[model samples]
Target: MIIAIDGPSGAGKSTISKMLADSLSMHCLDTGAMYRAVAYLRLHGDIPEHDEKSLVQLVRKTELNFHHTTSGTQIFWDGIDVTVELRAPIISQEASRISAWSAIRKVLVELQRKICGSGDFVVEGRDIGSVVFPHTAYKFYLDANVQIRASRRQQQLKEQGIIKDVKTIVAEIKKRDFHDSTRKDSPLTKAAGAILIDSTSLTKAEVVQKMIIEIEKIKEKLGKKGKTN
Candidate 1:
């Protein structure tokens, strides 16, 4: 059973997906972090992001592995721990920039599916449901108003001691939305049959509870069909 949690930044996809995965006893795959790791690599390594061949070669050589730590899943790139570094503002922008490239998405999406193929997974990303795991019946799209999302994001960064101007963050979020929604290869969209949740006023626990209820309903329906068949 593969569950997809698709949403933009600050929509609580990452937090909720991990919680949902734990509740369902499934692995959590953070596809957004995967992209962030790539961006972090290139930014520090001085790799040419504009060159498709160089990008592809770098991706092919970069060994990205996930480790289940006490704090949750941590990403390691080429034997170095990069989970904390991925949240840097520069890397976040770079992730959004490289994610639009066809070469980068192709490499990461393939590897993402491979990681989750053997286990029940709660995979979260912009295109997890619409592109990465389109065949899965368990799909969710989480969204909130732009201002609320910006506020949430700013607070999160503040808690991390990274001070970013709220207005600048909001502008960046809007720009990222435009790019992700307009990208040619796999644009972000609500997948057919996806359960949409407007999380404007919901807490993370509330959202996870709602998601659990939805998943149970789907599971019950699938069970009845299996018995009838």
Candidate 2:
């Protein structure tokens, strides 16, 4: 089974998806990180963002990998472990831009589908449920208030020692949301048949547990149908 978790930045999709994947003994695919790695490559390599043809060629040439372990997921680009480097604020900004491009999104979506097709995966991204994996076995749309999401993002950046000022982080997050939501290709939105969860007041553990309950219900229904047949 594939569980597609779609949400805005700082809405806890990453944490919740990882936990859910662990509980189900499935792989967790952080689709956003893949795009961020591409952005990091573009910036460091001095590749222009508007060059769609070049970006598509670059993606075709690049090899991205996800390494799973007991602790967490690690991302590798071209055989180098760049798990931490891709999370930098600069790359985050660039990722939003790169992800908005139709050519880039098309290439990455094909890669993502190929990966998930081989194994059960818990995939998380802004458009995972809506665009990338619309026919997933279970789909969820996680959301939180804008202020709460901004505050959470600020705290996360501070913990990582990436940024100090909460105001600046919050502003950047708002800008990213605007860009992501208004993008022409596969803009971020909740998928039909997705279960919406307001995560503003819920802890990560709480949200995971709630999702587990929903998964169990689906499993039970499927099991009953199997027995009936």
Candidate 3:
């Protein structure tokens, strides 16, 4: 089974996707981190986000690998462990911008599909269900109020010892939301046939449980359909 989870940043997609994947004994693919790796490379090279030609060239040569470990999944960018650098605010902003490039998204989406080859994967990203795996029967769109998302983002940063004002984080979140939703290339929207989960008041565990319940129902329905066929 391939599960597609789509949502804006700080909406608990990562946390829920990880827990759900672990519970289902499936691999977890964080597609957003793939975009972040591209941005991190660009920021390292001083390449402008608007430089589509350079961006295309950079992504063409990029290689992303995900490793399951005792600590969790670790992402490698071109053989470098960059899991720690992916969450920086600059990278997040840059990821949101460069991800809008059609060529860049194409490159990453191909890689994403390759990564999920013949495996049960819980893939989470802005466009996974709609673009990356539209045929997947189990798709979910997770969302929360912008303020709640910003607060969660702030807390996540604080946990990592990178504190920023809640207001500042909130503004950035709104800006990124606009960019992600309005982008011409694979804009973020609810995928067709996806179940929408409003996660504002739900704890991470509660959200994961809800998703599991939905999956169970789907599996049972499929089982019955198979028996009839």
Better of 1 and 2 by lDDT: 1
lDDT (C-alpha) at residue 142 in model 3: 98
Writing each residue's lDDT as its tens digit, candidate 2 over 147-171 gives 8888888888877885666667678
Q: Over the stretch 67-166, how does candidate 3's per-residue lDDT look in tens digits? A: 8643356878879899998888788888888898898888888888887885778899999889999988799999999889989998989988998898
Quote model 2's TM-score. 0.92
lDDT of 1 by residue, 51-146 (tens): 767867877887878775323579898888889888888889888888888888989888888888776788899998888888888999999998
Clashing pairs in 1: none
Per-model TM-score versus the true fold: 0.93, 0.92, 0.92
| Candidate 2 ranges beyond 4 A from true positions | 224-229
In angstroms, the error of model 1 at 63 is 2.3
lDDT, residue 1, candidate 1? 79
Residue pairs in candidate 2 whose N, alpha carbon or C atoms collide under 3 angstroms: none
- Indicate which candidate wins on TM-score: 1
